[model samples]
Target: MPTPELIPADQQLSWRAITDADLDGWEALLRRMAVEDKPDWIEQRADLEEVLAAKKNNPVLDTILGVDGEGTPRSFGRISANAGSNMVHVFGGVDPAWRRRGIGTAIHEWQVARARKRQADAGIPDGFIRAYVEESNPGHRALLESSGATVVRWFTEMTRDLAEDIPEVDLDPEFEIVAFSDDISESMRLAHNEAFQDHWGSEPRDEESWRFTVTHPEFRPDWSLAVIDKSSGEVAAYEISSYDPESKELVGFIEGYTELLGVRRAWRGRRLAPALLAEAMRRFKADGMEHAGLGVDTENPSGALGLYERMGYTPTRRSMAFEKVLS
Candidate 1:
């Protein structure tokens, strides 16, 4: 185990860079907190190997586990920045048992300091610190607001019942939807960048960062669909799906998740995306999925949230993005 760095506010409590040895204890802390805070939702296990792999891919990132004298992780935080964006993303959680103590604040303080140091090293003139909190997580929201973070954007979680028949939409004859394949990976990646480049806070993903999402343990290329421009032979849009066993096992029902859905500018208003979404839902239902879910930016210029609702998806929860400027 690595040496623990004691927090000034509480000597008994300390944090250290997490190692493979801390996986079990860290999992225990996350599971306990998830069961207590949201039993209805699945307890997603953090893959320590994958996380460590990410650190190798991006050495600037810092991941820490905070523990008490007994050596159980009471708080966790990850701080990372995107190249050229001058923005650092912060995500962390405190065990329910350790809430109301100074542990959470201390973790945030450490994250801010680490982010500043990284910015300095990179010679970034100015940067922004960003975090996301779901509406269901009131404690986190309160903490962010109290720490001078202000809401910058809102996101919605939408779900559709797979048991119901998906409406059949007549796709334009010029467009074709097909399963995602390694052959078209590069094309799809470029299309993805083109699709979201205009969106707020959008950052282009290099090959390394792009591979992390598609190669994740839960990624399901068989379920991920891509729309092709038949005439041009170019990818027009994509809906990348994944099999979330943790959520399925938690709720005792099969669920298909989509983390990314993009339609290139030229394909907008062509009914291409809606056709792909319907096809995706049908594919999920055919595979015995009970539900399909995705998160959408509420203020997306493409009118994504409205389109989702029109396609039979209902909002299950709201998540807000909070930001603080750090130079």
Candidate 2:
């Protein structure tokens, strides 16, 4: 556990482990930060509550919240590491009104310390810690750099206006696109693990995490689809989407966000990806969405960026992934 002294005394804030009681304040702070840092992605109270209730997360040990004298959350940090994985994923943010006060630095320091402790306890000798920041956020980039974390990768968020024509890509007769459902969820997870095996920073998501995603409040099963191999009866590809009401309210446009898109190695050349995307876009349009949004790794080995570009998506935002190797 990080000592109380780790919190910057100059900031006049109280730092401690987060609990259910902090949900309202934490979510409010996150919403405010998202509006300032990344308007398209906002974490709501339900999302934070789900994170706190996750079996894999130990908030008392791996999470920290810094609050002002008035008990308003100003900054917070949380870290997660799987039992056998060498990666520690860190997430948190500081209130926009409190920037440049060393509050972000303090939160980051606490996150790194907790990450190291987690790796040490797990006996991971060659692990690494990762955090992401928007390209427009120089303060966050500098903070990571000062901690010796290098920018390992870049990602771009793309949007397609539903008002434009969506191309029709025929799915090969050997495969069929099926609606996403609970019965095929586990199979799709296996297919996803296989599809992204060669992708950067890709790791097999455990059932708990996958379930959390499919059961999220914003998850739109009606908009999600899967490609099934006719002969093998296997899930060959998938496109999962969600509708963020807060984002629509903030951006003033109804957008269907594609959260995950993948095509297995064997099914790559069959145009399944484009077909799934096209079908998803049609559904989004039918449902009165004004735009389609998705994020992709700039260097995706599967040529995803090219695919999205050909599908009429334009880059709107960029983010950097930073990593620090643990000895």
Residue-by-residue lDDT tens digits, candidate 2, 80-113: 8777898999988899999898888778888888
Question: Least lDDT summed over 10 consecutive residues: which range in candidate 1?
Answer: 1-10
> Which pairs clash in model 1?
none
Question: What ranges in model 1 sit over 4 Å off?
Answer: 1-8, 39-47, 55-61, 249-253
Residues 1-327 of candidate 1: C-alpha lDDT, one tens digit per residue: 112342445536676777778778877887878876674343344355556566322422487787788888888887777665688898777888778876677677777777777788888878879998778878888888888989999988888888777888898889888998888888889998999899987788778767877887778888888988999999999988887777765655687888788999987888877887888888788888899888899999778888888888998778899998775
Q: Indicate the residue-level lDDT of 43 in model 1.
A: 31
Model 1: lDDT equals 0.78
lDDT of 2: 0.88
Which 10-residue window of candidate 2 scores lowest in summed lDDT?
37-46
